[model samples]
Target: MRMQLETCLAQAGGRSDPRTGSLSTPIHQTATFSHPRLGESTGYDYSRTTNPTRSALEKALAEIDGGARACAFASGMAALDAVVRLVIESKRRRVVCTEDPYGGTIRLLEQFFRPVGVVPVYVDTSDTRAVLRELDAGDVAALVAEIPTNPLMRVADVATLADAAHAAGATMVLDNTFLTPYLFKPLQHGVDIAVYSATKYLSGHNDVVAGAAVCRSEEMGTRLAAIQNAGGGIPGPMDSWLLLRGLKTLAIRMDRQQENAQAIAAFLAGHPRVARVYYPGLAGDPGHERLRRQARGFGGMLSIEVDDPDLVPRALAAVKVFAFAESLGGVESLITFPTVQTHAAMDAAIKDRLGINNRLLRLSIGIENVADLIADLDDALR
Candidate 1:
């Protein structure tokens, strides 16, 4: 029988030994698993291709993402790289992506993929008409989107985009790291492939760096697995174990994190120094209505535009509780200026087009007390 999300979190990958009844899944850290009689062994043969611990994590991920299969990787970029490789065959040479994608993804497409004959086209995915217009042109092999996007908090209509992509004979891939499967399941919304920086919300504690790809069909799963093995970006046994442990508490952690974020977004929205707040949870926000229709919740990420660019350094320095950091989706709150930190390498023109203003600040809300986080922001705004 299918289980509820909370039950899935607690028991999805906990395959206990019939003899011992251990509650937690043990890490199978060996580099290779021996076959008893030349070929008489379970599916696992080597660590590079598979490990018991990693298999557990992959199973859990597949369950969470509602996919036929899932693959785990060393980092989020590795997952993305594998997905991109799947679409970059000799006949299919171009990738259409959101103008406001994560900076690392932008770098991968421009600096790396471009040189290898895979061209990347950036479009404003929020504009459904524009996205459809681009797909009609037909050079695209894959279309990638990040819902309630990184740093910008731009929400795209996944089902709409997926329809457009399918009509154009292109695959639709979504980076669901920001919202996590708890708040949004891209597959149910028509996404063909769902990718996650498992290092983020899935691993919640910020202790592990990992990535995952979940595909709707066994064929896509095999293709992703092939690229993963060829590229050698599979996650280590320890990281897989930690990620599995984190998955157990994902529901509870996200409940608190989402609450903290809503409170903080309210605080920032009314602050005099704040020019604009980007959060789907806020009523009447452009994406709020659409988000209600497509997502389970508004998620835990928010972005604010300060009135002046110069105010950023002062505001960043003034915050007493929130840590100034680059990566996000940790147990502790984090604040960063993307133009200078995460998206520094992106072209200035591209940054402007994506509305990544110099004065914008990205906030990754943690499970901290709402009052305490607000007070810290109140003092910083002063």
Candidate 2:
């Protein structure tokens, strides 16, 4: 029988415990597993390479993303590191990337990949023509795109980008963190690989630190599996268990979070202190129509620019409900000054060019009371 996504979310780990009929997946927290015989194995030899709980989480991620396999990591950056190695291994050293990815990604590229001879060309992916120009220019091995870019909420034509990648003989890697599988499936949109920071929406409570990479085909899956085992950056069994638990309620969490987000975005759009609102959920946002074409929902992430850059600290200090934090997509509403938090590592020149500055604040709306959340922001603005 063909099952729906909502059904799969509730039953993330369908791999039931055969011995005790335990509904929850047990944590196999040992470094090594015992073998019954000298010539036999239990499928899981070492925790580093494989563990029951971790494998179950990987399976659930694969099922949700509609991929052949998923590789779990200790952190999102580690998963991205694996992708970089995978792309470089293809012998095509030149890569094209979206102009603004997470600051951590840019740091990794400049500090690590560039020194090794791999070149990255950055372009505004929201403009299909710009992306196509870069791809057509040649020698591009991969295209790493964030569905709707960080902080800015800029949308790119994923289907079109994937086609361009394929035409250029490059692999298309998508960061689907902003919109989890509940809102969008990048693999179905012709993306070769979809990576996620499971620490966010996948682990909606913000308790687990994990990452995932889902492959569109078995061949790619096998390669990613090799990277997972070889890199030794895999998450522990307990973290994996928590991620699986978080996935079970992903649909519900996102529903409430986004509901709050839409209301807040509407409120901010008309506010006197607000200069600009960056969210696809807004009817007049430049990327609103583009988002509708590729995703099910606009997501709970949004960013705003204050009327005065100097007032940023005042607002950050005054927020009562929204935590002045570094991360997002958790159960608690978070207010981040991207210029100092997420994008501080980015070059000042690029920051000015992209408008990621002191005036900008990114919001990660949670499953909190909409009215209360609004009141909290209202108090801060005053």
Candidate 3:
């Protein structure tokens, strides 16, 4: 019999022995593992290299992504850096990216990697022809995409882009932080590398800051491991253990969150004060058809274009339920203006091209009651 996702979440890496049978994985907080003899160490010589708790988390992650191996890092950027370091052979190279990626990713590419000669070319991935045209140029070392992209909810066909990247001899990397593995698995669709900001959906509580990378092959896994060891951004045992505990309830939390998002999107679509609603779950939305074919379900994020930019502050203040904040994928709903908050670092010209306007509000629907969430939005809009 095949194991269900919820079952995997509850018991994937669990060990229930009498000597160490604890319902929750214990945090192995020691700095080093003991070696009984002069030359024999028990897999972990030092905390920087490995720990039992961290190992357990990595094993769980690899299993979830259907990959050969996984690595945990101190932050999402660190995980991305580890992967990029594997391909940057010179300072004058380029990476192809989607037009609307997470703002921090764009900033990292422009500020850090650009100085080292790795330029990023942003294109509208929704247009397969445009993606093919850019890839055919042969300058791109890798292709990076964020399905259901941050704040915009744009869905990219992972298998199609992965085929293009592989045929061109470039790696296809995806940021799977938004959808999480519960709703979508990139490796099954041909992605060579999948990365995540575990701080978001994986952690599910907004308390821990961690990242992960899953490599399709053992050779790529070894390369990433070397970069992780040399770069030294591995997550501590406690954070890894916390993330592992959070993974146990990922399915339940996401199920409720998606239900709430669907309701909120419908409400916003019919509201007179809203100009437009962007959600992959909406039947006629731009990416709806492609999304239905790829993802198991529409995610818990949506964006609404307000009639007036000035109404944002009033609406935020009036809302008694939704919290006005940054970061997302928590148990509580969050609302923010992407132009001023998440995408502030993006250039004005690029922002205009991507349609991240001043009146666009990004809502991270949480695992709250659907009726309560809609009522709160209604009060705020009024």
Candidate 4:
């Protein structure tokens, strides 16, 4: 039966144990399992390639993404690296990507892929016509998009881009980390691959460090799994178990967090100190309508531009509730200055061009009381 996402998430690892009726999926932390016969196997040979905990996670991810299969990795970057390697095959070295993606991804492509002969072509994927034009100018191996893009919250029509990519003989890879499978799934829109930094909304808490990729077909999934095993960036059984634990409460956390974000975005929009607020949750946001169509909810992530760049430091230092930190999407709220922290790998000129400046601040709204979050920001802005 097609259970709702909430039901699926709540019962993330609720499969009954055959021997013990344990509600949670067993860790199966062993490095290797014993075999009875020399030429026989139990479909459980090594922990690196497969394990009960990781298998459960992989299944959950696939189910949520509506994909054939998924591969878990040590970090979000590792998952992205695997996808880049998977798509840029057989001399198709040129890949088109979102103009503003996670800085780490840009670093991976420029620092690593570029050095090894792979080239990255960046465009505002939200502009469908621009993307179509780029696809027309071929030699593109893959088109990677971060829907509701990092910090900026730009929305793109994934299905339209997927059609363009396919017509141009390129695969479509969607970074669904911002919205996650809870709010959206890229494969449903004809994307070939869906990637996530499971550490964020998927993990819910600020603890686990993990990544995931769901392939539209079993063949792509098998290829990604091989890359994961060969690259040795697989998540440990314990980490997989932690992600399972996080998934149990993901729906509730996201619901509350995005609610708080909507309230805060409203607060900031009216504040005199705010020059601009970038949150798709707001009806006035450029991406609001498209996001509504593509996602169940506008996510908790948003960015703000202060009228005075100088006040950015004051606001950071004054915040009593929001943590002045690097990462985001924990139960605790986090404030990040992406220009220096998250997107430091992006060149200075590109940062300026994209409006990722010192005046801009990114907020990772948590499941805090809506009033408290708004008050905290008001106090900081004052």
Could you estimate the TM-score for every candidate?
Answer: 0.97, 0.99, 0.97, 0.98
In the range 130-178, model 4's lDDT, one tens digit per residue, is 9998899988999999988998989999989999999999999999988
Model 3 misplaced stretches (Cα beyond 4 Å): 16-18, 89-92
lDDT of 3 by residue, 58-155 (tens): 88898888889899999898999888887674232779888898898889899998888898898877778888898999877888999898878888
Give lDDT: candidate 2, residue 195.
92
In order, candidate lDDTs are 0.89, 0.92, 0.88, 0.91
Listed per candidate, the RMSD to the true structure in angstroms reads 1.2, 0.8, 1.5, 1.0
> Which scores better on TM-score, 1 or 4?
4
Pairs that collide in candidate 1 are none
Which lDDT tens digits does candidate 2 get at residues 189-288?
Answer: 9999999999999998878888999999999989988988999889998999999999999999999999999999999999999999999999999999
* Alpha-carbon deviation at 93 in model 1, angstroms: 1.8
The whole-model C-alpha lDDT of candidate 3 against the native structure comes to 0.88
Q: Give the Å shift of residue 296 in candidate 4.
A: 1.1
| Winner by TM-score between candidate 4 and candidate 2 | 2
lDDT for 62 (candidate 2): 91
